[model samples]
Target chain A: GAGVSQSPSNKVTEKGKDVELRCDPISGHTALYWYRQSLGQGLEFLIYFQGNSAPDKSGLPSDRFSAERTGGSVSTLTIQRTQQEDSAVYLCASSLWAGSYNEQFFGPGTRLTVL
Target chain B: AQSVTQPDIHITVSEGASLELRCNYSYGATPYLFWYVQSPGQGLQLLLKYFSGDTLVQGIKGFEAEFKRSQSSFNLRKPSVHWSDAAEYFCAVALGDSNYQLIWGAGTKLIIKP
Candidate 1:
């Protein structure tokens, strides 16, 4: 079976610009999550979606960060007015369900460099 | 707040030597524990997980983890590590709640020396 996949393996953008990272989850998966990884900060959760339910966006660092999952399969994470501090690898993951015990499959991740 | 702790930032082990990565978690209630491995240029792969039942859990690639509730720890172990086992290992915990948001550790870089 196909695992989770992400697009734009690498992205370089100037500060103050906006970036969008895409994620394609496995078929039949009902839960999708986004996380960011930096040199100092291991991996920080960004947002998560479970089917059509309301997304849990508490992990989003700021209001500029937002994510949307369409049709319960693909997800897009948008960072508005990106800052140099936002330079990091954005990872996406998916699981069969949203339960705490479900095992998540991760994507290769998209590395975004804010210069 | 839920949090995961990986005390060792890096560890080196010789090929064919035993390996152990310590993980401690803090949560209000019983937590869902997980260990994941990430190669240099690959996505994270699950090593094992502890939800309930048996405290010892086995995972792919000859990896296993034992959950100890008394210490609130879930440590990953491998009998004999191969050179290819060098990578970053992360410990994560999910709170026993409806959201199930995961709290991740800083990750430990595993180095294998021949």
Candidate 2:
């Protein structure tokens, strides 16, 4: 079985540029999550998708950040205009289902550097 | 809002010595507790979780955690630590009604000495 995978292990971009990060969850996983990890900081929850239900966007920092999960398998996190503060590792995770009891598997993550 | 706290920013333990990482959480009602380990340049690996039933939970790699409701704590412990155990440990809590969103701690960095 394959684990969660993310694209562009490392990305360097200028400030104000837009970037799209992709995540492919494990086969048959119905719960997807996105998180941001900054240096010396904890993992910050970004967004989450559970099957066909509405995605939880409360954790998204700003309006510039958005995510879409298509066909309940792949998820794309988009940053419209990146800022220097947005420089961090973006991690994706998935579980069999969205619940408090299920364990989530994580991806290697994409390190985004805004210069 | 649910929150987790890892009071120790860093801890160093000699190899073959007992290890304990303190984790305290704040949330209304019973919450789901978890401990995860993350090596440098790698994704997080779940150490253990406590949802209900037994307060003591065992996880992979000889790790275990005790969930104490009286203190609102879920501390991770291991009888002995290996050098490979050096990594950042995170304590997270999730409320059952929050759609599974986790509130994470600042993390504690564990260092192993020979």
Candidate 3:
């Protein structure tokens, strides 16, 4: 009965450093998503995974932002050579299935700070 | 281009006062709309959603929303708001044929007064 869970509630890294945020989706949730919430801004879509494969990576801001899912359960969002602009709360969500109707359950976000 | 707009950047209401948050979307097709609330230091929580039905939809925490195709609007309403309702409200639209792409609004911050 666990909801989505994300690790390392907070991460502070220097500019140009790399950080990996992890997410554990609820059991049987085939659809996983990653999002970024910048200060004073709305949530920015990052990537989505159905099972262990990602079909839509367009939301990724750049090559530096990448995400992957494995075993259809866990996901990792990696930000390489982070910049100040990348300092934000990284959130993950999962749903029973992928589509417009399904409600996504969100996890407590990982607050990443790039100094 | 698809976009969701929340015209009010902030709204303040006393506890027990009526509340209405406006949302408008620009899309030719009938869209799936959602209202989410994010309390400070917490994750986003779904308030309600409108896929297609009787237009009026009820959701958790004593909230409801009406989808008006005539105006391309889906406004959230609560007859009486509690002090704990003070938070950020976001309007979003699910677009694309199948990819779960959601277009989000800038969000409206709600303040509660005693």
Candidate 3 deviant stretches above 4 angstroms: none
**Each model's TM-score, in the order given?**
0.95, 0.96, 0.97
Please identify model 2 stretches exceeding 4 Å from their true place. none
Predicted candidate 1 versus true structure: per-residue lDDT over B1-114, tens digit per residue? 668899999999999999999999887677888899999889999888888899999999999999998899999999999999999999988776465577899999999999
Poorest lDDT segment (10 consecutive residues) of candidate 1 chain A = A48-57
Using Cα atoms, each model's DockQ against the true complex is 0.74, 0.70, 0.65
Instruction: Please give the RMSD to the true structure for each candidate, in Å.
Output: 1.4, 1.4, 1.2
Which whole-number lDDT from 0 to 100 does residue A53 have in model 3?
Answer: 91
Candidate 3 lDDT tens digits, A1-115: 4788898999999999999999999899999999888887778898899899999899999999888888898899999999999999999999988887789889989999999
**Best first by lDDT, ranked:** 2, 3, 1
For all predictions in the order shown, the interface RMSD in Å is: 1.5, 1.6, 1.6
Candidate 2's residue-wise lDDT over A1-115, tens digit each?
3799999899999999999999999999999999999988899999899974545798999999989999999999999889999999999999998877788999999999999
Give lDDT tens digits, candidate 3, residues B1-114: 888999999999999999999999999998889999999877789999988879999999999999999999999999999999999999999974474978889899999999
Candidate 3, residue B72: Cα displacement in angstroms equals 1.0
Candidate 3 is scored at a TM of 0.97
| CAPRI category for model 2 | medium
lDDT of each: 0.90, 0.92, 0.91
